[model samples]
Target: MLHCPRTVARTIVYSGIFLATGVSTVLAADPTGDWKVADGVANIRVAQCSGNMWGVVAWEKTPGGKDKNNPDTAKQSRPTLGMPILIDMKKKPGVDAWEGEVYNAKDGQLYSSTIKPVGADQLEIQGCVLGFLCGGETWTRVGPPIPSSPSNSMAKGAPKAAPGAPPKTAAPAAPPKTTGAVNPAPAPKAAPGQKQAAGQPADIGDICLLPDIARFAH
Candidate 1:
C-alpha cells in the first residue's frame, strides 16, 4: 500500500471517477512487472503466482520503512519492503482488470480494490472503503511487460509434463565410451549485458516467490 498522506488525499479527491468507471478497455492487458507509484514513493512488483495476481513493495525512495501502522502488533516491527499489498486478485471475465483486496499499511486495513492497466505503461489502482470512499492513482511502468507465468498457468489446471519423462524428440545416438567419469555440463550463464527475460528471475525476482504472497498463492 502507498503509505503517504498525499496519496490518501488524492484517493478522496478522485473517488467519483473511480466509482464511475467500472471497467476500462481490455487491451492485451498484462500487469506483471515493476510499477512506480503515482507519488513516486515506491515501486511495486506484480507477478502471477499460483494462478493469481499479487504485488508487493519492491523498492521505496526512502528505504528501511516499517509497517508501524499495521494493526497486528506482531507485524508492526516488520519492514515495509517486500510487504504484500495487492492480495489474491483474480482476473475479471472479459475485462482487463483484476479484483481483490488491497492491504493498506497506512491504516492497517484491507479495502476492496481493482487494478487495471491503462495502455502499455500505466496501471490504474482503485480501492473503496465500504464501497464509498473510492480513489486510486496510475502507476508508471518501470519494467518490460511480462507474459503469463508458467506457474500461474499450471495452477489454472494447465497440463504439465511429468517428472523424469523422456524428451519428445527422437533419442540421439550414443556417445563413445570414455575412461574417466564425465561430469555434467555446467549450466549456461547470461551474457554480461543481457536483459532478463520477462517472467524469469531478475532483480526482485518473482513477487510470488516472496513469503507473503506465497501464503495466498493458491
Candidate 2:
C-alpha cells in the first residue's frame, strides 16, 4: 500500500542487507535497541520488559529546531514530550505472522500493525487496519549500537552488579485442585489442505510480506 517509490527504496535497502548478511543475523537486531525512526525524526528508547517490549519517546525534534528533543507541538493532550508506548506482539499460528499494536506518534493512539520477518535484515511493517487499504514499508537492518561515552564507567564494560543481591525467587505453588470437574476431550481433526497439485496458488502467508502485499489485489 505504500507509494511505489518508497516501497522500491525500502526493498532495495532492506534486501541488500539481507542478502549480504543472512537473515538470522539481522533478526538479532533487538527491538530493544535505541532505534531512530525513519530519518531520525525521533529517537525511541526501547527496552524489554517482563518478556514484552516497551518504548519511551526519549528524544524528538522538528526538522530544523533549536532543541533537538523538543518539538513545538501543542503541550496539551498531545504533548511535545514524555510519552511511553507499549507494543504487544502475538504470533498467529495459522500463518505464523506477527501482529501487534503500533502507536500513532501524532495522536498517541495505538493501531493494529502486522510485521513479518524476511531474512535477517528486514521486517515488513504494515501500518494499517483494513486488509486492502494498508500502507507498508520494509525496515532494513540498521547498524549496531551507537558507541557509549568514555565518561560512563558502565559504558566502558565495567563489572556488573553482584548477583548476590537477593536472587528472584519463584512464587509458592498453588494448592492441588480438589473439585472433580472433568476436562473436555479433544475434538476430531479436519481434513488436510490440498497439496500444490492442479496449479494451486502458493501460500502467500509464507511469502515475504512486502512482496506478498505488493502482489495483493486491490
Candidate 3:
C-alpha cells in the first residue's frame, strides 16, 4: 500500500535524528555481545577492533533457530552468518551513538541502522531502509572485554561552577574629579577697508580686495 509522502519524510527525518543521537552503554570500541538480528534470522558477536572500532561476527539462524535462512541446510557454500558485517568508527570523538549500513546478502540491499545501549549488559538496535521497513532488536553483553575509551571528541567532564553561589565580581573604579578653572580668549577686530566691524579684509584674489569695491563691481 502507498503511504503519504509527508508522513514518510517526517518518519525518516525523525528516525535519522534518533539514530544519530541515541545513547548507548557499549563503547564504539567493540561489539562483543550477543546481538540478536532485528529480523530474527541472525545472531551476531560484537567486539572491539583496533582504534576503538567495532566488529560484528554474524551467524545464520532462523528466528527460532530453525533451518530457515541457515546456510548449513540451505547448501550455501559460504556461511555469511560467521562473517563480520558491521564497521564502527572511532576516528573522531563526541559520537554519543552508533550507526551503520545494514547489508542484506540475499538481496544486496543496504539499510541504515542505529544502536543504543539499553543497559550495561544489553543494547537496542534499529534498522530502516525505507519508509515502512524498519525493525528493532535487543543485544546482550557477553565474554571478557577490552575496555574502550570514550571518543576523544566526546565532551569532557562537568564545568567548574559551585551550586547556588553568586558569581564573582570585580571592584568598581572611582569617579573622576570634576573641579576645574574656566578661561576665555579675547576676540579679534576687523582689518582696514572692511565695512563691518566683524568682517576682515578680503584676500588679494577677491574683488573685495580692490581699494574701490563699487569700481570693481561696475
What order do you get sorting by lDDT, best first?
A: 1, 3, 2
Question: Which portions of model 1 miss their true places by more than 4 Å?
Answer: 1-28, 151-202
Candidate 3: tens digits of C-alpha lDDT, residues 1-218: 35688889999999988775553333443344445555545545443332333433333332112223423454334434343344442333464456765445554455677666654566666678774589866766543233333222222352434888787674497423111101111222224653332222111111111222212211
10 residues in a row with least lDDT, candidate 1:
178-187
Model 2, span 22-67: residue lDDT tens: 6455445334333445554554443333223334443444321222
Error of 1 at 130 (Å): 1.2
RMSD of each: 17.7, 25.3, 40.7
Tens-place lDDT per residue, model 1, 1-218, is 66798888889879857664433333237787778898887778777776668888876666567999988899999988888989888999988899998888889999999999888789999999999999988999876555553433334344546999886774497533221111222222445875434342224555665667655563
Best by lDDT: 1
User: Which has the higher TM-score value, candidate number 1 or candidate number 3?
Assistant: 1
lDDT of 3 at 149: 31
Candidate lDDT scores, in order, read 0.71, 0.41, 0.42
